[model samples]
Target: MLDGLTLDQMRVFVAVANSGSFRAGAGKVARVQSAVSHAIANLEAELGIALFDRSGHRPVLTPEGRALLANARDILLRVDAMRARARGLGEGVEPELSLVIDTLFPLEQVGAALTEMRAEYPSVAIRLSIEPLGGPVAGLLEQRCQLAVTVGEDFRDPRLELRALSAVPVVTVVAAGHPLARQAEGRTLAISDLADHLQIVLTDPTPLSEGRDFGVISPQTCRVNTQETKLALIRAGLGWGRLPLWEVERHLAEKQLVRLASHALGRSGLLVSESYLAHRIDAPLGPAARAFAQSLMQLSGPRSP
Candidate 1:
């Protein structure tokens, strides 16, 4: 009975389930509503299960249908991957090389990589996404990207390979007019003194580092999703936080923000942030992807500061 089931039927089932009605699903699959209904009816007949409960205004998945929905999605994903791999084998270049990068990676380094990538693979399409905290790694895990440059900590997967990129300099900073800046009399402040103010923290939506505060100094904390937002808050004197030195160099020089003495904050004078270029071990990158990755690595190579 299951042998009669086809990919078309599975697609129709998924479309109807997602869209909530045969008419809506028809619009999605570009077929007539009757055709969509027929496909699902045939699929249900073959599987001998009532996939949808159509008694209500909207169709809802039956218990058996709910059990099979995940399997159907997985099958479709595998089929898509097989098709993509086959296409890549014939073309020698990926149709699109999706690259996700951490926002903390120097903009100049990314620009250098993109310049080289464009020169080497003019025809290959590049999809670039900038994320922060756990987002870069999440992009890789969720199959949104084929590669990533990440600075997230303690995140590892057996299916991924990590290549060392470069270390970014992280600095604790505050607006020049901030209370902490005003209180510091050209000396480091004690932990208790610092804890009185708000310490902005960068947090990820993902559960990667649940209940953890990476560099928070104060018990009073503000959590932000991205570094740019954190930087903006620091500049507004709403809170103080850490940012990559390269990112705040201009602000520091312009007197918009001032770097705190790390020793007074009970930290080393220097905190080096490490980044990595990561790709999946199971799905090796195509030529264009490899070239783009190499370009990023080349630009991020060791240099005397």
Candidate 2:
């Protein structure tokens, strides 16, 4: 008997329960009141359960109907999603978008872009990875990710296409109580002044950038893989390091971290790190991937020098 139960019957059942009347449910499903009532009656008979109580002026869901309403709604929603996914595939939309982003890129911008992407392509799944230094590029080269956003202006790889996104300011900072912070109070510190202090630096996990160090002036150093760990260690007064200004702006404003002023930091103790959007030259982006890329570009605005 349950094998005879149909989706139309479930739909009519849910519609009547939600609208609280057979006539309203019929209007909701574009069927007449008699047909709606008949579908509900068939559903109830098949399950041998009283789905509605018609003892009152308007129909009301019975305890059994209430118990199963959620399951019925879930099934309808999944079917809708499956249909959307099928339509998207037929339209050449990618089933999934895999993106790897550099740790230096502002997370807020990434979140905003992804939010837009989700609204525009709900059927496309997203796989996101946050990596440091060479990791994003490596993910692209290895075909582990379909797209990448990374820092650095120098991508000489012939197999990849790179477009400038924006420039993120990198600032040298230390805990408010660190010795370096105290040293930079009166006057600008010289390059030699940092030689004695332990510098915290981010290391690339991939061999693509193995043994290569960026902006390492201090002889004594602590190496970390993630930016958060480096920031935490620096906040603890264990060391000083260069971090993205966007990441530490609040700390700097709250007096938790002090920006270092030094002649060694060329250009007012600020370094402009250029970021780029990258992908393989061999593989073009699909509809969903292209939409996501456009979203990122639009949200990021004009590239900063």
Candidate 3:
């Protein structure tokens, strides 16, 4: 009974059912209306069922046709996925590219690079993680990710291969109404001025950087796990802290936050931290991973080491 069943017939049937007319389905499937009609007729004959009711002006799916439509769609989807995966395998592309990026890295650049990667390698699945401090390096070390974009210069591990990506400007910021902002109108505040205020610090969740403190000047401190939480607390005038300048540019422009003039941070109160593209020296980059890494480098313009 299923002797005449073919993918072409099922495709035409599904197209006609979805389009509600034989002519439209023919156009959709890029075949003539006669071919579409012939395909549907063969499919219905093979299945021994009336797939469509032709009594109406436009064809309507029968109960049996409605029931089979979902199966047809699912089959097509699986076939497409199979073809894509097979193509990727033949071309030596990785099945998936897992990447872990430092939370301080600009998301806009990441998004742009991903957009390009998707267009170039549609079959290669992406697994992305945004982690703070040593979390990114930990993911790479634990084999959770194949590539990592990390901030700072603490990556001295011989197991990793690093390439300088770009420098991100870190700036100390406080809410416009914070006491420090009000007191430092035209003068640079000394480190002693910040000692009393509760500095909302981003703490590393991983033991890889347990004993390290980056740019912490406050005696009274409030530790947070995520940058978003720290930013929220800072916006609430609860404390002051250093954040990537790109992250707080909008708030600075809107007058919601004010940049602190710190004598420790020199004249501009900006610290440029180098971010790097890292991967294990032992694990060679697959095609997809290499492509994505190239895209990131192109987007950020790789810095001279």
What TM value does model 1 have?
0.68
- Poorest lDDT segment (10 consecutive residues) of candidate 1: 262-271
Scored against the true structure, residue 72 in model 3 reaches a CA lDDT of 86
Candidate 3 off by > 4 Å: 1-91, 302-305
Which ranges in model 1 have alpha carbons more than 4 Å from their true place?
A: 1-91, 264-269, 303-305
Model 2 Cα lDDT, one tens digit per residue, 1-305:
47998889988988988888999999999998999988998888998999889999998888998999988887766665566445555667678999999998998898888888889889989899999888899999899998999997544465567888888888899999999898989778788998789999998878877657788999999999899999999999999999988899999999999988787886657888778889876565777787778888887853332
Ordered by lDDT, highest first, the candidates read 2, 3, 1
TM-score of each: 0.68, 0.68, 0.68
What do the candidate models score in CA lDDT, each in turn?
0.81, 0.85, 0.85
lDDT of 3 by residue, 177-251 (tens): 999999778988888998878999988878887777877888799999899999999999999998988899999
Q: Candidate 1 residues 1-305, lDDT tens each?
A: 48998999999899998888889999999999999999999999999989999999888999999999888877876666676566656767667878888877887887788788878888888788887777778888898999988874567764567899988777788899998888764777777877898988878777766876566778999988887889999999987888887888899899999877757543533467678998765465788887888888888965322
List the candidates ranked by TM-score, beginning with the highest.
2, 3, 1
lDDT at position 176, candidate 2? 99
